[model samples]
Structures are given as C-alpha cells and as structure tokens.
Target: MSMADRIKTKLTERFHPLLLEVIDDSHRHHGHAGWQEGGETHFRVRIATRDFDGLSRVAQHRAVMSELDDELKERVHALNIEVIPADKA
Candidate 1:
C-alpha cells in the first residue's frame, strides 16, 4: 500500500473516525530534507474521531504519533496531523 493508504488504514482501524483525510504532501517539499523522486515522505492527516474528545491537543497528537511509530521509523519523514473530536467535526 502507499504510505497515505497505510496511514489511513491504521487510523481507521484505531480511531473509527467520523471524518478522515490522509494527504500525501511530499510533492510540496521537493529538494527539501527527506524528499525523493517517488514522493512518499511527507503527509498531512485530518481526522475526527470520538476517541479524541477528552484528550488535550498534545495528547491527541502524541497518540497518533505512537500509533504510527513504525512508519515514522521506517520511511515517513514528516507527518502533519489535525485532529478533531467527532462531535466537533
């Protein structure tokens, strides 16, 4: 699967989001750190899930980072995440 798809899959399985968008933004960073010809190094994830409701923003981000730890270590160089509580979506 593509990195964005993998991220979407993992997030879906874990968060069961009301809204989710995993965007591959690697193309925007050409020639910058971690950029490559094929472009799977950077991403932006916008998600809304009940699971995030009570969490502070920092906690929410940390939770997502932890969930995608392997991807970060393996290939993904940067991830921009915007999390929303389902009710707020």
Candidate 2:
C-alpha cells in the first residue's frame, strides 16, 4: 500500500477520527532534502479525534508522530499535522 494509505489506516485504527486526511505533499518538495525520486517522503495529516480532546498542540503532534514512528524511521521525511478542534469537528 502507498504511504498515504498506510498512514490513514494507522490513524483510523488508533483514533477513529471524526475527520482524517493523509495528504501526500511530497511532490511539492521536489529536489529538496529527502525528496526521493518516487515521492512519499512528506505528508500533511488533518485529523480530529476525541482522543486528542485535552491535549496541547505539541502533545497532539506527538501522539500522531508516535503512531507513525515506523513510517518516519523508514522513508517519510516530514509530517505536517493539523489537529482539528472540537469546535471545528
């Protein structure tokens, strides 16, 4: 499966988010550091889950990063995360 698909699956299994979007933003970083020839090196994840309700922004990011640790250690270079607020959800 693609990295995006894998990421989405992981988040779904962990958070059961109200909203989730795992976007492959690799193409936009072409020729930059860690930009591989085939892409899948960077991502933007937008998610909203009750699991993140009381966490600070940094904690929210840490939670998602922890879930995606394997991917980060492998090929993913960057992860831009947006943890949507309850009001937004």
Q: Highest TM-score: which candidate?
A: 2
| Alpha-carbon deviation at 77 in model 1, angstroms | 0.7
Note each model's CA RMSD in angstroms. Answer: 0.9, 0.7
Q: How many backbone clashes does candidate 1 have?
A: 0
Q: Estimate the TM-score of every prediction.
A: 0.95, 0.97
Among all windows of ten consecutive residues in candidate 1, which has the lowest summed lDDT?
A: 80-89
lDDT of 2 by residue, 1-89 (tens): 99999999999999999999899999999999999999999999999999998889999999999999999999999999999985688
True lDDT of residue 70, candidate 1: 91
Question: Best candidate per lDDT, number?
Answer: 2
In angstroms, the error of model 2 at 80 is: 0.3
Q: What is the lDDT, from 0 to 100, of the residue 83 in candidate 2?
A: 90
CA lDDT, candidate 2, residue 34: 92
